[model samples]
Target: MKKDKHIDPYKHVAFIYPDIMDFVDYKWWAKYIYSITVNHLKKSPSVLELGAGNCKMAAYLSEDYKDYIASDISLSMLSGSVCKINKVCCDMTALPFNKKFDLIFSAFDSINYLTSKAKLQTLFQQVYSNLTDEGIFAFDAALINNSYKLQKVAETSGNFNGIKYYRKSKFYPVSRIHKNIFRIYFSDKVITEIHTQKIFEFETYFEVAEKCNLYVADCLKAFTYRKAKATSDRVQFIMKRKT
Candidate 1:
């Protein structure tokens, strides 16, 4: 079916995203990250968060750190932020920042959107350049197990006020890609947004970080301190500069 209007990813979703993700406990998530910062760095540090969609988590996280900046590729998403901290619209692979941050991170499997090993490497390079000597880069990626779980859902739909939205989700094992197609119905037209994420092997991230002069400080299971395994559904990687 041809869509009446094709909006950028997160353009229309931004309006209802909070409602869609109302189940998440941003407070708990913020606490988890904050604890990691305390354990790893031993002090509150300057922070830069990449792919901070709507900065909802930032609303709960920013106060604990010395300095914080939330960034995303979509301006529309940043415009919907729940917090008042610094927000910047920029690509994760090519960060534009003059000052280095003590802790640069991304959450919610945002790194999976890179879709290519080359892009992942570029992101690591950017992180390497933007990190303070003792800074760390922390992020998560959805594993194949996550893709399998997503495929089980297949489709979901919801309505906000009078606006209707439907999502079709699929995962291709052979291609290692997870795609979500969203159709939002408005009074005048329908808007469609396609989002694709690559499920890379658990080892690939370590390889990329090594090549970028970054070393893995830890790789943990989501929401826990246990080391992540190949069979894990989602994994968080904490990396530090080699120097």
Candidate 2:
């Protein structure tokens, strides 16, 4: 099958396998993201989440905020979510809103799918423009070692609600890209989805943030308070629009 480069990969999966979210273990991650976000902002601040997949994390963090908007490119993906909040189907690179927010964030390595540095900088600028003077834009990055320095094949196969799925992940060092292939065979239908994410260099992030006039306040190893290094598997970067 010819993959559509223009389409969001999750769109098809969401339509065909909406029940897949129930099988995944995403609670711990949602809690961790909330922990990092809560400490930086006050209670009941307007928030925007980019690449909010299935609204799992938003569901976890929404109770503490006054306003929350979750946006994803795929409408089907957003619909699969149980969250009953403000949801929008939109691209991450071009946020189509004038209302500013106190905190803007993205979770689950969604930014890595941005294949180039230019797109990343544009996203940073958009987030900066959409935030208040002292607002925060928090996101995480998968570092070089996360994709390039690993030689492993990790997979999870399971059945849920009569749907059987096999998800396989493999990293290609030459291109510094990781591919997640989800093959679902159920109800006499065979659907395969290929999702890809790139491992960006540490300095690339700082350079893009600098170009966008956004100052990074924290770059920590994910799920921990340790400083993020070039080799950190996953690094969370918290930034704000320059005052």
- Give the winner by TM-score: 1
What tens digits encode model 1's per-residue C-alpha lDDT throughout 1-243? Answer: 974542346888776677678889989999998877767664668899999998888988887885889999988998876688999888888798999999999999999999999999999999999999988889888999988888888898988878899989989999999998989898898998888999999999999999999999999998999999999999988999997
CA RMSD, predictions in order: 4.1, 3.7
Question: Which segments of candidate 2 are over 4 A away from where they belong?
Answer: 1-6, 15-28, 148-151
Q: Over 4 Å off in model 1, which ranges? A: 1-8
**Per-model TM against the reference:** 0.94, 0.88
**lDDT (C-alpha, whole model) for all candidates:** 0.88, 0.82
True lDDT of residue 100, candidate 2? 93
RMSD of 1: 4.1
